[model samples]
Target chain A: MSAFSTGAVTLAPHRVAAMVLRYLYLLRSSWTRLLELIYWPAVQLLVWGFLQFYIAQNSGFFARASGVFIAAVLMWDVLFRGQLGFSISFLEEMWSRNLTNLMISPLRPIEFVCALMIMSLIRLAIGMVPVTFLAIAFFGFNVYGLGLALAAFFVNLILTSWAVGIVVSGVLLRNGMGAESLAWTLMFVLMPLACVYYPVSVLPDWLQVVAWALPPTYVFEGMRALIMEHVVRVDLMVEAFVLNALYFSAGVVAFLQLLKSARRVGSLLQTGE
Target chain B: MSQAAEPAIAVDQLVKVYKTTRAVDGISFALEPGSITGLLGGNGAGKTTTIAMIMGLVTPTAGTVKVLGAEMPRLRYHVLHKMNFESPYVDMPHRLTVRQNLKVFGRLYAVEDLDGRIAALAREFDLSEFLDRPTGKLSAGQKTRVALAKALINSPRVLLLDEPTASLDPDTADWVRAHLERFRKERGATVLLASHNMAEVERLCERVIIMKRGRIEDDDTPRRLLIRYGRETLEEVFLDVARGRGEAREAAQ
Candidate 1:
């Protein structure tokens, strides 16, 4: 018997890497897809950067910390790209009617998820790097100046995005392309709740409770604290990490449950546009 | 007396119920190693659903499916690497070149010396000419060959094929059937092919299992089915079964 004949399902790193390689091949093959990764983020940065420039000139509060809006925009892109990176990679398989092929392969669902996460990171890097540099060049706002705290913000926000991505993927698995719009629109539902632009205090008392429950809210609050007060809120970072861990776990459970349901319904064979 | 060897595939009381629809209902069969069994059925006859269950892609509501002695969808990992499936309905990523798609599947199966394997499959499937072309750009016959190459990349012992030659031309379809026979003969592989093409089934399958509305209607060799149904061709038998004629008119009397 082969090594895989064991009772427990072992995670094969090579299979995960192979999935990542597949996505990379697809990304490189299409010039439009490659350009798209960098396109929207750059535009978002340019628009928000100039808007912040105007506000900073007129308002004393904005003038005190001119990079705040620009920083927020860049950070938000990390979450957006991270979620899109994972969900779109999955949607690509469905769009091509390849989900059944992948489902039947030796590659496990967990391995597939890991590959999506890694691809999310790769895509986030490609999309954000150029735009972050543009923020420095055009608007004198270096998002990297957040220094070591930037790592915490990224990890926390990306994890939250993966949580949302997995949940959306589960819906798509059960509902096919009909629910694909959740990939793009679902994140925005969190945007207001996440308090992406303003602090949690800006929300009404009742809504602030909902905002605080979201991991991204903690990251944004932490970001503003660092930029404005120049004091890193280690407590807020810890809270974000803890909430992210919970949500990520829930996402995995929800995905596996939906996959099981799909199999029970025999949708695995029929999933596509 | 010697005990019979374990079958390559064993299904006992296999059933899958999608809500109120019984996609596969309480069917049973065993396929010996190195055997090619054609699963014949109409559109809603559960052939694809059965294949999906065996591949561990779909969970059976009841009954059990064992592939190479491993129970499906639970212990599938034990045998997944040793089995592969292909169908015209499923597709590979379109933008990736044939060689790239092969390479990706090869790595997914953790095949040793993937480049050598890809080269051999390209040669065998006559894919060398268009190995670098995007898969979407390939003709239907070409795409079928590439799908076969992908399915065979793992050198699977158990192969499940669904309408493997559905859209191919006569020449290409015949070529594919010949290659499949050669592969089975050389590797001692077991194949469970589900197809509507009666001629292909008669030529390739040693045994055929006919299903109707999630139940097996008949199980026998092509020659026997012809005699049993009092028909000159398997297509006639298929039509009779599909049209709700259970047995030959004289036999029913």
Candidate 2:
């Protein structure tokens, strides 16, 4: 009886931190989900990447694309895979009905979001090598001297994807399998628009404006700047960081509100409800 | 029984409505420490709904739920860390092994002597053989055992079990009952069980609250309710309630 009354035990900051650490366990446990994160980008690197090589043969694309592998392509992998990390982990919980276990536990809504962010980060971290390896193998280019920006770009990709995941998770919690499709579809919509395969400069100026509004666009933009210009553009990094923060914040607000709305509607009682 | 005794769970006019339907209509009941209260109702009678509100898993259209006398969700975390739940309908992550699942839950509850706690349950529940197996691979009985083990990780003061033995064999079912009894004796914990097994109700619960159409139709000890209602067993009592007969039987009295 003494134990039952211990503040239902809200997740303290350390516990929240620990949940973020523990949340990455989901990435290790599900290889199928992990592979899904790698699969799409791997396909793009293999198929379209070689075509880019065929076109770049005489166009000095090799020298132009030398740093492109690390700068542009790898970061895009991080975004797609980061979304995968968040979407798959959540979908796993919903499919298995383990969301109730999480919801009922002392873990708060913020803690849950933070945990998803942690998982997204881990996925993005692991994806860097494979994405680089695949594109390097396909395109035969040098993408070094960008390690410092790599870390920053990775963080931005992870933060952005996790923010996307929170919104996706809220919908999935309400509609079950119906909302899971968005997990894949969101990456699909963002992929071409982010101009990952090409530069934003390659796109028309107005479309680049739309790309600028997206965090991944900034991620690639910063990565491309590091590789092509070899100069730290403070403004671009700040823009990426701000956009990622905004998305992450929006996700947290939406998740918290939808979760409360869901509880008021009693959907937690029945996943379908 | 005096009302002064510390109540383990107190629900004050707890009401829940789903759309226009009153899922649980103005129900109030208090469970004393160490008592096992059985909630009995047919499908859609709001048994789960009422329990959900109490667990802070559902919001009442109107009403208050206090567990261990703390207004829920506000004090929800403080109390919930000391609480545990098991339901046949819920599942753990399929990719995790039984050992991993238990370890995760045990850590969540922050149970001291973690290894000892898990080892004890594994032995008591005969889970040592497949403790390394993924939770998804376990049979229904094994999964329930794992779920039960997960629920008891904290040695909770309050246990909420929904269909504790839904798919278990008689032997496993008896083992679960014995384990629960041992837990209750050692901890003096309160258990609120929602089950359809009448024999389980007769054998376990000292007080049975029968619900119908989102309200309690009757509340009594199983044997007393049996004799008073001209029934021979709890199964018959349940048949009456679930078939919409308990209300009439209560009126006749």
Candidate 3:
């Protein structure tokens, strides 16, 4: 009999839930924490909502697709909150010096990743649901109007965020909290390249080549297609999914390898700001 | 093999090199079941690294670590639930109450009757008053008690402790030590304690392993260590090891 057979299922749901419960307890304890999750998304929505209103009245080009900016802002927060959600959960363990404790627990690394992913979804919902409603209320843009296509976009963008979040977490593991800024700043580097506010054709030929290589490029292109042309680009969504799969796998591998290196270098206990 | 015949913890030529420094250098030892071993060392002497390796928190560069018949970090999950560690340096989430913190840990350990366990630990640690208070609001002594409660949440068979009583007053420290002794007696748990308190080591540990510069300088009981080093106390013996007088004494002998 194998020694590990006793608990050798690939995933243990209770263990994953335990970690989720830990973060939930933390979230409920502080009202500021609960507010902070919703605060930034709401502020971003309002700022962009008024700006979109001004442009729609002034520019015929925007009047034809007035809801584009609101939709973009809402989806972008999905990506941001998803990534931040994951990184914050991991960082909370580090700041408290509890990573070592969790590492030594029976919870597997994969289970920990699952917990991060689940918490990411929870935090994303907490931050974005209100902002989406605000978008409809303030700018008359119903993000949900995209119907099933909205889900494809959300999934692709959030997958890409997890990929980036995992890689950022890896860098923090290898380099310590000095690299903590990467968690917040890294995803923005992809925003312009993602063509969030404009069509891919707006970019110069050389930059378009680089933009097409990203998963989000396909997502935004698909988003604009659904809004402006009233056409669903299943082909673009498929391409985004394929690209997200590759990046997310690479991210997971990089994280596990970095954690191994940390163990070899004895840095797990020393991880702190 | 029978449980008594097999070692609870077995380390063989374990080495961990962190860049240029060898944090743990080819150390080897074994602990019989239910034994308390004091792992004593000065600053940068590899005690913490060794404990981390045994807990499967650190990987060995060379050789192996076996806890309860499973290789460390590789097959750690097979036996992880059977082990737990406590350290003053590691903190539970501060915003979580003492009770909430206990609940989280109990859930992670998959403890059965978790509410009952928390209640028992709270009463045993005299934490009933502070159970609902934020853990960060507690005094240093109160926090240490809570940390101990968290460590024992799993009722682990192997316990690794690093400076388990660093910040408590003398009276509380004595009380904590007494409880630890009682815990080991009642559970028959194997404890590997890394502490700077020589008196605590002498009073509780059946065997002592003295390390210096990532090596085992001496391994014996406190009484034998005192006689061999011609010292009056384990603290003097520890100083001799830390100061490199151990080699001189061995050479003179």
Q: Best-fitting candidate, measured by lDDT? A: 1
TM-score of each: 0.97, 0.90, 0.97
Write the residue-wise lDDT of candidate 3 on B81-123 in tens digits: 9999999999888889999889988988889999999999999
Model 3: lDDT of residue A95: 86
- lDDT per residue for candidate 1 within A138-171, as digits (tens), equals 9988888889999999999999999999999999
- Model 2, which residues run further than 4 Å from truth? A1-40, A60-70, A134-144, A198-209, A225-231, B1-4, B249-253
Q: Point out where model 1 deviates above 4 Å.
A: A1-9, B1-4, B248-253
As a whole number from 0 to 100, the lDDT of residue B25 in candidate 3 is 92
DockQ of 1: 0.73
Instruction: Give the higher-DockQ candidate: 1 or 3.
Output: 1
Model 3 chain B worst lDDT window (10 residues): B244-253
Q: In model 2, how large is the Cα lDDT of residue A229?
A: 70
Compose the digit string of candidate 2's lDDT tens values, residues A1-273: 012224433335544554554455555677875686667667766665666566667678555755465345556667777787777666767777887777777666765666666666666656556766765675665454465676677677778778888898887765566676898887778877787766788888788888888877777766666666776666777788898888888987887778777777788867732
Runs in model 3 deviating more than 4 A are A1-9, B1-3
Q: Global lDDT for candidate 1?
A: 0.92
Error of 3 at A100 (Å): 1.1
Residue B14 deviation, candidate 2, in Å? 1.4
Model 3, position B120, has a per-residue lDDT of 96
Which of the CAPRI classes, incorrect, acceptable, medium or high, describes model 2?
A: acceptable
